[model samples]
Target: MDRDEAEIVALLRESVRQQRMWLMVVVGGAVVAGVAAVVLLPGARLGAPLALAGVGVFLGVLITAPQRKLLAQLGLSRERAIELLSRADIAGRTPEQLRERQAQRRTMWRVVTAVTTVIAVIAIGYVVSQAGNRVDDNVPGSGPTALFGWALFASAVAGITAIVGFVQLSTFASLDRAMSAEGDEIAS
Candidate 1:
């Protein structure tokens, strides 16, 4: 194979490896968190989301693993392999397509992050307003303290979601810009 083909193969292998590693880390962390929540909270609902997240990650990894393996085992031509990878949603996306997808995703995430941030702020305000009443509220899950705890938890979760959304938005925006620049360079 030519140097370019060799480079593409290397990149594809590295991409698959990195993706696998990242999925493993995310799944492991989610499982640990879910188990801890189940053990600590018992009947509480905190573990549901974590369990769901872990399942989703596991499913994604499983769905992509076969494609990566087939690509390696097929020994197809480079272009054909790349096209197959693209069909599998693995790699070989044109810069224009990538840029467009990134722009759309960033726009959607921007709106979502904004809404979540606003909700988090409102929850925070409610928590602050109810803080004074928490002094005498000593019930398990049915009083001012319980309300305060739920509100605080909601605020924390929403805030973290907003932060993660913002980070994803920024990443997509940056990727869009980079792809645009790469397209421009290719065109020139």
Candidate 2:
């Protein structure tokens, strides 16, 4: 309600936004690395595209956490600002108003979580499938060098999936918190 509190909320929002921008940078770098790997590494052509795609998917997972944090913070801040404005105007609140606001916030969070989860799952599955294909390409007649290349591709995909899963879990936690906050608001 106070000026100080408003300032702090603004700062927090800004910090989260900045973090999201930085994540974009990291994602771009990963894409470049994936391309370079394909071009420079011997027999890496089959693996490069898969690695790049995996990196892109993993970056989405990584960005989702910060995105959720920012959304939560922004939603709360907006709600607080509205409440403060209402108080200043001496406007009476109705149950419908409260319910609408709660519903809007809930919908926002639900959409974000559902979309991100779907994307992450699809990406993970794609990476896994690509790795399997690469392995199959390394059949006995494919030569020892191709087999080694396939092994590297599989390892890279596995590593990317592990990291993406961890990030996705963190994002899911943020979504849970947002949902809990909405529930508490409705109860009170």
Top-TM-score candidate index: 1
lDDT of 2 by residue, 1-188 (tens): 23464465455556656767878789678657656765687554454577657867876777666645654655555565546445543345564565566567656656655655555555556556545443346465453354444445545555465555556556755766776797789999
Clashing pairs in 1: none
Error of 1 at 173 (Å): 3.6
Per-model CA lDDT versus the true structure: 0.69, 0.58
* Strongest candidate by lDDT: 1
Worst window of 10 by summed lDDT in candidate 2: 141-150
Q: Which parts of model 2 have CA positions greater than 4 angstroms off? A: 1-3, 44-188
Residue 88 displacement in candidate 1 (angstroms): 5.0
RMSD of each: 9.0, 10.3
Question: Runs in model 1 with CA error above 4 Å?
Answer: 1-94, 137-146
Per-candidate TM-score against the hidden true structure = 0.48, 0.35
